[model samples]
Target chain A: MHEMALCEGIIGIVEEEARKRAFAKVNVVCLEIGALSHVAPEALKFCFEAVAARTIARGARLEIVETPGTAWCMDCSRSVEIRQRYEPCPSCGGYHLQVTGGEEMRVRELEVD
Target chain B: MSSERIIQVERDILGKNDRLAADNRARFRADGVLVFNLVSSPGAGKTSLLVRAVAELKDSFPIGVIEGDQQTSNDAERIRATGVAAIQVNTGKGCHLDAAMVGEAYDRLPWLNGGLLFIENVGNLVCPAAFDLGEACKIVVFSTTEGEDKPLKYPDMFAASSLMLINKIDLAPVLDFDLDRTIEYARRVNPGIEVLTVSARTGEGFSAFYAWIRKRWAKLKQAERTAQG
Candidate 1:
């Protein structure tokens, strides 16, 4: 539901960059979605198509690059891959883990003219 | 004939909101205000707790509230009844309150040189987790009846929050609510999160909650003072 806001932000950036870089149209918008961010890539895609219908990114392909969740375990003093926030640290099986990555929802690249 | 090129447009989808959030943070800091963003599911006693807290603490510290709902001034009215200034933000169809909305609400709020402001976000777990409203810290309110699996089901919300208040603990005896297990689960999702159990009805555990607020508020003021020096 809030994906509409995110899509609008993306469109705002794309339009700004288009004006600055003199791009007439956009072809693809690559996004990096983090596992911990809880943003549904499919929903974002649907929103992108809908919100960008009349913008420069109209019909642009959305390429989602998923990033894995990473957290630092306090007990083990090491970083480990985490699938979910509630999952114990895979290395030391500890709950005292601080998430360090995989919460990104960014537009990494844009294929444009 | 057209040629396509991949432009390295590395930007966050939430960049605009995040930027506005930073601005809000700067404004709060300049004004020496401690702001908290409160989130919870619908019917989780968010407003009840806020009303109670404001009623108790407004005399000690000037308090303001921004109530977010899809449509309604009811929560704001409740907070107003407590004698604290409250602004109701109608998000319309929006599920969450973003920095822009908070920005507008902040402008409408009573100016406090150094005080506490609570933004009660619209009742939803998922969407609010992604939007930053320039709060000093995010607080999640969970009722005892909601079950311990809430952290697992809404990991993002728990992960984003710094504190979790287990509301309606007065009914702990009637319901099979596992206090220890709920804390453990909350810690599993947010390792550094501080959890406190309280019941707005019984006023139980509110002193601890109030103490926590005073501590944080003082700390924020101290930081501002130090920065000014």
Candidate 2:
């Protein structure tokens, strides 16, 4: 799964932060995952544990904050919340909705010792 | 006893890949090379389409290919047989190609200034959608034999692609593929996606594909000239 690669990216970020900030160990890694980002939180957790072994983030707990998917409905001329990309606008029932939010996968913060 | 402290990072998870991709894009722009990333499921005829396209367009334009696969270099071999430069990047347990891999592959190839570089991404619809290799556009190949609901099932890939090529159209009549519904589904996910139907076997609909590439290339050249002036 690509989650493994994403986890590797996370580890790289964490290790870099550790070097820059003079941190000895990481206790928790906070992530902001969007519902429409297509990345599964559970898979991220599984891969994070495997990829974090022996690193500064080894045994670190992952805290994933899920953000809702949001889109701008061109027909309704209003913003709408969507759970998926193919979803139609709730108000006008049109497929002309432009995704406005909830496609992010960011590492927001970290808890370190 | 050590105390735990929170550190604010505020970084995108794919930030490294994105930066690398931006670098690749700058390199491509400097060379005036129009690149397209071709993606699809396994056996969606990505290599076949490239073989046919390169064979016809090589005389008119200098073309190079980067073939990504998990194991074999067979697809690269197929492209090389057409007397074009093609390099194979074997991902080795990786599901998709990343920007770093593509950058390395591009470095290995000969200079292809004022030409086209086609990257045939590993035959996968899911993971490849997330990684950008600095391509001007992404073309997704959906064969008729793969059923129509693929766009619905794999909305991310469909949504990310700029153009969808309905491959294996010659087998559409023999199978129960509904061409209209497939287009509808793809459009539902991505309203701006362009669609074209073709068969690599019969060399059908390739003229339109070449025309599309030429149109984009002309626009790119115009933009480059305007930037210089």
Candidate 3:
């Protein structure tokens, strides 16, 4: 749903970089998406192709680097890996947690000509 | 044959939006306008609450509204009926409002002097949660009829919001909705999120909501003064 909008944003970045770095065509785009970020990888890929059409990134392959959701448990005072936002701390079974990582959505790298 | 090159972009996908959001934030701070982005699913009473709040607070402080929807300037019309400036930005096919769109709308809006501006985002929880609209904070509203499991289903929206307004509280007693459980579920996702129950139709909890807004507005005004001194 919103993946299309996100893909549009990605294309914007790609085009901006192309203009700055003097690249004509983009071959691969590696993206870092966190589990807790709520972005669907498959949907993002699908939308990326559709949005990237007729652009510098046309026919580009999307390389998604899925990052694990990490949180700091308040009760146990330790960093824990979480699968979902509503999930309790894996180590302490407590809901009191502060999310530390795995919420990032960024374009990590690009292969271009 | 063309040779390939690896460019270390390493940029946030939303970097452009974040930059524009910072610009919007600076403009707002310079003007001392307390801006709040109201987001939720459709029919969550965002416009209703705004209409009521504008009516109540317009006398004390100048109020403005930026309404976002896929189509229709009706919400803007409704807000303007309260004698305040309201601009409508139709997203067409876009599900959420981005910072660039908000910045454009802000530029067109009149009355840049000190006041409060409410940017009502298009009705969708998932997409809006990802896009920051350069507001001081986000306020997510959910009706009691939407069920308590909403937070569990849409954790990102709950996690991103600074305040959660449980709207339609007057219908809570009639429905099978468990208000306590709803608040508990919201806290499960967002431990620090402030919750307030408000019935925009009945004006039951407007006082508390207004108080929260006033507190933030005062803080922004104070910052404006300190920056000047």
TM-score of each: 0.98, 0.99, 0.96
The per-model lDDT (C-alpha) reads 0.92, 0.94, 0.91
| Candidate 1 lDDT tens digits, B56-101 | 9988987899999999799999999999999999999999999999
Q: Which stretches of candidate 2 lie over 4 Å from their true place?
A: none
How close to the true structure is residue B72 of candidate 1, measured as C-alpha lDDT?
Answer: 78
Docking category for candidate 3?
Answer: medium
lDDT of 2: 0.94
Q: Give the distance in Å from residue B92's predicted Cα in candidate 3 to where it truly belongs.
A: 0.4
Worst 10 residues of 2 chain B by lDDT: B183-192
Q: What C-alpha root-mean-square deviation, in Å, does candidate 3 show against the real structure?
A: 1.4
Candidate 3 overall Cα lDDT vs. reference?
Answer: 0.91
Instruction: Output the lDDT of residue A22, model 2.
Output: 91
Write the residue-wise lDDT of candidate 2 on B1-229 in tens digits: 7688999999999999999999999999999999999999999999999999999999999999999999988999999999999999999999999999999999999999899999999999999999999999999999998979899899999989999999999999989889999999898888989999999999999999999999999999999999999
Best of the candidates, TM-score: 2
Tell me the tens digit of each residue's lDDT in model 3 across A1-113.
Answer: 78887888899999999989998989999999999986989999988988899888999999999999999988899999998999998877889989999999999999998
Q: Note each model's CA RMSD in angstroms.
A: 1.1, 0.8, 1.4
List the pairs of residues colliding in candidate 2.
none
How many Å off is the CA of A48 in candidate 2? 0.8
Model 1 misplaced stretches (Cα beyond 4 Å): none
